[model samples]
Target: MATLTPCFLRIFAVLQLAACSFPEEPGPLISAPAEVVRRYPVFVGRAHRSYTRQEPLYIQTVLKVNRTLYIGARDDLYRVELDHVSGDEMFYSKKRTWESNKNDIRICRMKGKHEECRNYIKVLLSHDGGLFVCGTNAFNPLCANYTRDTLELVGEPISGMARCPYDPKHANVALFAEGSLFTGTVTDFLAIDAVIYRSLGESPALRTIKHDSKWFREPYFVSAVEWGPHIYFFFREMAMEFNYLEKVMVSRVARVCKGDLGGSQRVLERQWTSFLKARLNCSIPGDSHFYFNLLQSTSPIIRMQGRDVILGVFSTPSNSIPGSAVCAFDMQQLARVFEGRFKEQKSPESIWTPVPDEQVPKPRPGGCAVQGSRFSSSNSLPDEVLNFIKTHPLMDEAVPLLGHRPWIVKTMVRYQLNTMVVDTEAGPHRNRTVVFLGSTRGTVLKFLITPSPENPYSNTNTFLEELEGYNPERCGDDSVQARQPLSLTLDKPSHTLLLAFHSCVVRVPVARCQLHSRCMKNCIASRDPYCGWTKGSTCSLLRPGTRLPFVQDVEYGNTSHLGDCDGEFVNLFGM
Candidate 1:
């Protein structure tokens, strides 16, 4: 064998160290091929929570069990009941407001003067069969419970001493399995410490999760919770001033075991261990100012197939990439990461790739890229393609579109937004997950994993193509266009999925809809057109004297109303 030179030996050493030090290329499991299986429009209605001119940063799914769905919109809560055979019947709770009485004269004439009236509702399921909700009213924290069946207020409103010190804009709550609750308080640009408490029979013992201002940087903004053998808390760290320019922010998923908290203390004394932490790399270049404020109202955690823990998130890029992206790490990965055995060594930023046509179950006619990268294929591109982009920096400056490839160009277009997994079976699909992503202009997508024969960890691509079946152009209807999904829940028993979104409640069968005509006709004739109903269908509207099948009552912005279908048909017919 020829002897290696000293320079070559040193170079080889450096390469070996780099390989060992960096996180192993996320293994084959991370890069397994994936494609869209279906994409369907979900209608969530137009009601939203807004503060001043700032759009609400987060929306949360409070409880999803059976066919009942509960959602949190800032300070209010909404519920939807879905009929396995029909569709969705929706109703919302009254907007609970806060008032303060300062003068006796005014108190005599009025019940009381409200200092503040807010509609934010953060909810938790109590281990003791109660539904606990907490939010800021006026400036104070208020807690309430509801009967499991009637959802009627179970007891007098319990008030917490903790006050929302922020802009009345971004306060939220999370609960642990042990019945402990955490509330994040934000003031102006700063997120204060999380207020912690445990419900002791009737009252809650409150304490604060504290850290030195200098060490922790931004205070905790509670984003998610996990309950199993232990309790985990997830939060977002405020972006540093320099990071603001690059549109980078760090998100952390941390946890404290249930065994750690057993006493009267409101907050746990132990430090949280991070299961997974990532620097959110936005897709849109130069839009660093567009921070994802999802911490206040999004549930990044969900129990899949009844047992597995599924975590999801949406990170927006401000630069050239013009969309929000979705990605997920499985519970096993989370456990390993939490144990400090796993660390992310890949680029803090996510890479995007286009969905191959053959991989898509129901291929769309137009070319489009899904916002994710294959861990295994990261180095598969031709050297020339990489070199060309490297040499021609101007081409790199142009944000790549989804289908335009040389893979690197396509990678630049996607960003991760939100992800969820619905397990069809325990063995192969055990770790299988579904990712829902939102684009910059508000297009939502759905993708799933297709099993692969070559690799145990690697899966073939299969997009959830049915979701896009209701094409507005093909159907000559706009109602079928996919809208931004606010929240998603899976009904395991019935194999049904419900999407809560900005426009309407959309239901897609785990199996195809057998009653396609009834489903499409009802959707179109309803005229509210929130749900995607097929076009050119023989759906008939109820006559003027006919009683409507269902009535929708909504409570939002501190007001409530019962909307009738009398004139709704006119709007549906374009009359």
Candidate 2:
């Protein structure tokens, strides 16, 4: 027997562990189990071919007659149809073509008169048996209607009479009751200011209301609209003096109601009566810099329950968290803020309620893991393992950390967690709600919402654990998980839920009784398998040239790849 030095023993021990840690080839991809849900194909327009950006900042969906679904892409709109049998596979078709033909006669004619040509589709909707399309040109509202079938531009083109009296960049329009439209725009070249306009009836004229009060003059941008007795508008106020060190300014959600602006008709002198502003705390503690990239994109208010409002916000920078949060506020509180009278000295804190932490689902686990070691039983190393170790020099340090464990090595990986919340009809037992969240790296989380026993305002949410990550091959290479926006629209009359997501739209049948009870219970127990450490135990170090027992490959069914059964056979029967 040959004796080895201590240094040689250490090198041999390290080499042995490296040989075992490489992962085996993954199994063949399996088709997802048959599911009885309708999946519709979404058309994202052929013009989307030119949009090479990885993420789309804006995404909107509308249901057209004849069961056709139209999706608004960044530059164009697409039409899609759904299959009735399987909810997994979807077919896509192009519905409308948006070619930027600046030299076209019709486009040039429309722009020549108003001097607001630069045509771009800002909003698309099928309403009142016609297609209502709105866009901006030179900061003016360009409204047009088209025939649903012929796609011919009908009705006279309408432009704002006053040229909006504000920057076209800041203008946004919202549909009010009875064909009434409300437009809000920000002015002031140095400091931001806001103006609201109301238009009613044919040959609708625009009336501008300048809100110059101290509260209204704050550098805030109007982000969303909610319909009620009065149209509720939400704005995000930016903090004065941008913090270069922190990379973010303070922001908050504020609202103004119809009556607060003097019955929605008073044009220029109208003032915001009810103001409910809550300071946004998006900063992580102890971090000198802010995590989020932009404030305007973070705040969006959408309708939740009939009377409740939900605000979706991204806390961290665009790339930091890769997840957004939804906060809820009661509409009743908002009504009080607009109607209730108070002294200027008295601040109205009761008018706005923050969605409690219990109401929000906990953050899902991120997708990375520390590297570990693998110990091989084979005396001769595999060619693949040798190459992997050579390519990944950091694995040298990681193997020792695991105490030379017989395990595979992997690195820290991250994934996206896109989340959305929706309301369901009240059931006999409980009000049914669901949260659909998808992971970019490959998991779709369907969380069923149940009322919390301890908190009336919060809910006990459960996720589906059996379905983990999404299969990468299914979503394609260009598919982005982090930037994909999830939109859910509920058609009340049909009792159907329409979920529009990346690549496809899913229509789920909302049952009177809860299904997947077992899955829900298991998920609640496991919290969807989000908690756990990597499996396997570490190994003890051995001296070099010390003959040791071969370790079995646990993950590979204990198959040994060391000694060749094909090699010259030794006389093992008499050993």
- State the lDDT of candidate 2 residue by residue for 292-314, as single tens digits: 22233322243334445443333
Total backbone collisions for each predicted model: 50, 15
Lowest lDDT 10-mer window, candidate 2? 394-403
Q: The CA-based lDDT of model 2 is what?
A: 0.36
lDDT, candidate 1, 1-575, per-residue tens: 99999988876765554344322211111111112212443333223322122343234345674566655555445554544222222333323322322342243235332423343454545545656665544444456776555566776877643423322445344554444554334422233554333334332333333543212345455554655554444555554323234533445454433323222122122222111132322222232332233332233455443434333344433432232332334455554433321211123343322223343222111112123633122123233333222221110011121211110111223333443434433111234444433332233344444434653333333333223312232112253223344445566554545654433445554432222224433333222211222233323322223333422111111112212333223223232
- RMSD, candidate 1, Å: 19.9
Model-by-model lDDT, in order? Answer: 0.37, 0.36
In angstroms, the error of model 2 at 445 is 3.6
